[model samples]
Target: MTPSRRAVLAAGATAMAAPALAADPVSLARDERHWARVAALFDSPPPGVIQLENGQFGAMTRATRAAYEQKLARVNRETTLYTRRGALQDVQAVRAKAAAFLGVDVDEIAFTRGGTESMLVLIGGYSRLKPGNAVLYADLDYDSMQVGMESLARLRGVRVVRFALPEPATRQRLIDAYEQALKANPDVRMMLLTHLSHRTGLIPPVKEITALAKARGVDVLLDCGHALGQTEFSLRDMGVEFAGLNLHKWIGSPLGVGLVYIRRDRIRDIEISILAEPSDAIDARVHTGTVSYASVLTVADAFDAHAAIGPAAKARRLQFLRDRWAETLRDHPRIQVLTPPDPSLHAGITSFRITGQTSLGQALELKKTLFERHGIFTVERPGAAKGACIRVSPSFVNTVDHMDALVAALKEIAA
Candidate 1:
């Protein structure tokens, strides 16, 4: 089979420049040409600014950006004539591509506006839990899930039990905590698991967790917004009841695309979020009307770029950057690294609580300081009441030198 245009270009770029990447523990600065192409993906990145926030949103790859632009222009040109029939076909093509990437039946995958929408639809569709019933979640799961659960708890008269894992965790420890939580709340009909925790950068053992939940007669809904392209997993293997994730975070797609996977058997169990006549498809959580067609269609290129990097290579590259920065900052007196040192516990995202600072205050200061003094840009833990923390995520396009410069800047700031 002939190589894809993206594959050829990525391979060529990887070969041409690798010094900063090769010499350092983390490397995104391989070749100037590749870096330039990668950098161009961000619409308004400051000159010399180093972005370590891929967990929030990733800049689209050149392929993805170009594809979006081309399709967008075409859509604009045909605005008057762009029929729902034609757009639906395009969405179907994108759906098939997304399904292939996720290793599921195309009929099993439904598109949503983003992670928030996906979760809301799931929460609403799951009418099985009543007021006396309970829905279990973790303290570290994305705040959006917490909000969704809260709203549903109020509407359905269900109890929402928010569980917390012990800090500086391990796989076994996390499992034990979850088991205990579930045991205490035996009436729980639904459980939410995060493949990766946004707060602590801890990735739970999804398969094991889901298996345990299933054995106990509980349905699992995985908040995979931080997990999808950042880490690789097959839905079939994980054995979760449903999984929903955003494409914008790690997949390098446009902002609005998200995916919700409804297990084949459970599709009939939940009601559709939007009123729609019965459909033949097994997956039907996609209930919103008039979605951004271009945004959803743009999801394919994110998969393509991810595939071009190859899953293993991308995993290694993300770990490299994360470990590089974490290992570097471990010795600093003021930094309390929250992400596990164990590679299994983290991927591209790392978070730490710094000494003697409030999260929001520190965030504001750092945001201003980095931009004004060092040309770096990052978000601080604005809501961390326990302490101030900074979260960093580096993609394959970020070189080791970027990590080094970031560390140097941090050291200077600390001093």
Candidate 2:
């Protein structure tokens, strides 16, 4: 075999030989030494920082980080081999693992750089939209997806209907608003639903909404960017035609890796906007040129990490922290909780606004002050509400003490 072909085969063998099992937690339970090792994988305190802004980016764990480091090092040694065919096998393995976790066939999932790219692919791929037809989204949708819709509207000369969720919405009211929008714009051929809104931390009843849209002949694209690792659900259960999820967030994978799901039958009909390399294959829409193989390969580690920890246990622990802290701040007169207090309506995220505050600058200052003075790090925003407020997202690694520290920071600032 040529040296290049031999190297390619070797890398493929290594990836296939990589263990799929979860890391041993006995080390975590038995020794304080392991805690520091695990903690080092995350952004360390004092310089790197605490990451309550996981809604923005959740860095990888020690296992996934090490896996990427090793893979990248190996790729550096065999660049030609990796660039040719090894990269393909690595990405396929990750995609297959992600599909298994998502409860879909391997062919149903597509690898994308991240959620934004995935959303662009979905919105731009549809051939149905024209001047009179509309794309339906809402106030709660992520800004990136919203921008994609607006840009498409501008470029395609179609109308983009952005709706609102009634303040302090009841479950039925939330569903009704979407239904009403669909009814009003009967010409709406597409709907972009955020399974979990980044700002409000609200999770819509996606299955119900998707079913309603399908019955009306509207194609639905669901964004699970904030929902995937944070909540428990099956993509098959939601029945949406297209969905995108960021693996880095709740799954704790390496950055720049995401999964896009296209319903099995619809793959051929959607044209990818991304220019792909020439290939005789199925679902060419996903084969965008020269993706990062190291990041893609770590997605499997993210899945393993998630499963090993136990989803139900992780969910309960995260939600517990949010609820415990949110309840304490809920009664503050100056605070207006944008997220519903009901646990069923949300997950790890809880966002609110300080009643009198204004500007993202003020919010940012508050976050910095809390970190500097009280040792709590969080995200602040001049959000789509009364005013600026801090947002907190705790992970499975966080403890009740973390919530207590946050509460203390709020009390100090509020006082």
Candidate 3:
């Protein structure tokens, strides 16, 4: 019985240097040797294609994947016997860890199937809207979330106010836009503020906008699908009472895990929408029946791998990878970098368009060309009001060379 190389690496015994967590994090971001050690925690990409489309969901690390598989097997073998015996408590324990990791109280959070489920629960469950009262969301928000907000127009008799966020957005401009929209729609009682836009990797000024909304007697529902692991911030500091988050994106968990957060005082504002399934706690917001126990169980391991890299260090490293290619391509004559130079507005997730390609067809062709001709994998995201673009989200597993390869490919394609 010999251990595999993945097993050895999974145990954290490897040639890669352990993360120098004590070092200045900004500098550590560029310390290739240090990052090389951190990168060793996951297996490399396949032989031909380089994966740059991590924004859809995070691929589990080796250790986390192993734990997920083991738990999955246990669930299959034990069946109802396994889940019936303390699984609720077990799931709640993992929820507590996630809450602590995100700097929130354990009671304030509950696990859902994925970010979309969380969004739907929070939006679909909001109890404060009245007939003619309005809710707001931006064009940059996730498609499913946008639809959920639209549904409230019928479900709760609230008007769904949709706005397009300013492009080449600045912190001040973003705040101003929300302020103007609120001022114009005085009847608006709630707003959906996307903490991070997957389409353009736009991080809005959430706290500032939330404050603005508060001044106008508006409540905000925060969407943190892409913000959790890679972006550095506290939920409290963002000043949102309701939020939907994902574990599979930046948190590096197994698929099918997500979270819902409501400030304790505001819990009653989001009613338990699950018919006949009553709960008074935050869990009241979710009733995902018969979820993947393995995905939820493996959360502790994913949280560990994220913590070992350390939030600050991980944020710095991901931003570093983002800037490596974005900075290089921003000035190119034929390429348009959608994410601005502002560090606060983006993480590792970014999107760009070939100068003349704004239609979905053009973006799709460019994505296909990048994949089939260039061997660089990315996804076409088409929600930005301006037009469609290709998204490049680099995980910590990606190397500087991967970014460089993308830069080279874009240069060739654009030429």
Candidate 4:
């Protein structure tokens, strides 16, 4: 009998893992030696360009990329046979692996194309809203999600409430704002919560805010696209029943892999978006037609690489990198670090705008200058109260030296 394509791909993936297994396990402490070994697992960015824009899309590990390529080749060769017969078990296995990683039941997880799709499905298919009912979202939520909520309100004839979080926000202030909003809008049926803000890298007090929303009989949808792999926390800890996560962001999987978690009991509250093949299974909630099978298959490989380094270690490394650069620029006169100095409120991502650069164009110009003059790569994020800013996010693959270089560049730019 001819060996199945999936078997071939799995064997190749196993071969790709040998190098990772041979390396010393990453340490939780800030040991440069251990981290340098881990950094070798990823493809380096172009020479002389320090990449601080990992929040846009994470770079895939060498092992996972090889595995993805093998899977893609197999799928291309086998075509329908791979999709119809060979892919089912592989996909289910990946789902089981993801469920285990997330600390949730298999039935509660549904694979989607990416975070945007998962969020749009949840926000659009939510069954609890009606005319005169209200939905709430903050200014810091992802632009795509915010647009989805607005459309949802318009289509369902529901009131949409938008709020702006304070710039130098504290935990107490954030909680108070949410509590006051819920109290003011007694008709609010649902609220969208971003576990981590992409603009300023603000880590909101999710568990506390979710509890407040629950007591007011409001359902919360958590956008954990940036939070999951960057930080070590499980859905159970978040205390929210619905969430959308991106495997590609911090998990280092291939692009276009994400999942939605619906609590087993609360699954019924979300209407199924795909009507053709109606079923009560969690996957029925979102319809994704003919997605890249190879991308989904590689998630298990990414998880394996992530596990070898340890999620706790990865979180610490990211936090350490953020602080390495942030600490140096905190006192600079011309720099305004938008992310709070509070350690609990931030992680790998942080943003800074030059004192006089406030608009989008100014922010873009600053990013360009950093790249052309200093050989550093950063991104401009708009929507902050003061103005647009440059977001700096370091991944596990980044080194302490890279961050040091970033600090030097920032200092030069400030001068």
Best by lDDT: 3
- Residue pair clashes in candidate 4: none
- The 10-residue segment of model 1 with minimum total lDDT is 16-25
lDDT of each: 0.74, 0.72, 0.86, 0.85
Clashing pairs in 3: none
- Cα lDDT tens digits, model 2, 1-415, are 3446434433432332222123333223322333333344444545434456667877665555666777777778898777686678777777777778888988887888888778777877766777888889887788888888888777778888887876676677778988999999998888899888787688878899899999999999899998888888888888877888888788887788787888878876567545665432325666566777777887776676566554654565567668777888888877666777767678889776666776788788888787787766777754454455678887644655667777776776777
The digit string of per-residue lDDT tens for model 4 on 238-330 reads 797999999999998999989999999998888877653677878888878887899999999899877776676777788889988897788
Ranking by TM-score: 3, 4, 1, 2
Give the Cα error of residue 264 in candidate 1, in Å: 1.2
lDDT string for model 3 (1-415, tens) is 1247447646672232245457777998888877777766776878899999988888777877877888888899999898999777788789889888878899999889888999888888888889989989899999999999999988988888898999878889999889989988999998888888889899988889999899899989999999999889988987878999999988888988999999999998888866536767887678877889889989998887777777788888889999999999889999989888899888888899987789999999999999999899999999888899999999877889999999999999999
Off by over 4 Å in 2: 1-44, 47-50, 277-282, 383-388
TM-score, candidate 4, is 0.92
Flag regions of model 4 displaced more than 4 Å: 1-29
TM-scores of all models?
A: 0.87, 0.85, 0.95, 0.92
Could you tell me which residue pairs clash in candidate 2?
Answer: none
lDDT of 1 by residue, 176-281 (tens): 9889999999989898888887776778888888998888988998888888877778888888768777888888789887888887777876785466777646
Could you give me the TM-score of model 2 versus the true structure? 0.85
Scored against the true structure, residue 164 in model 3 reaches a CA lDDT of 91
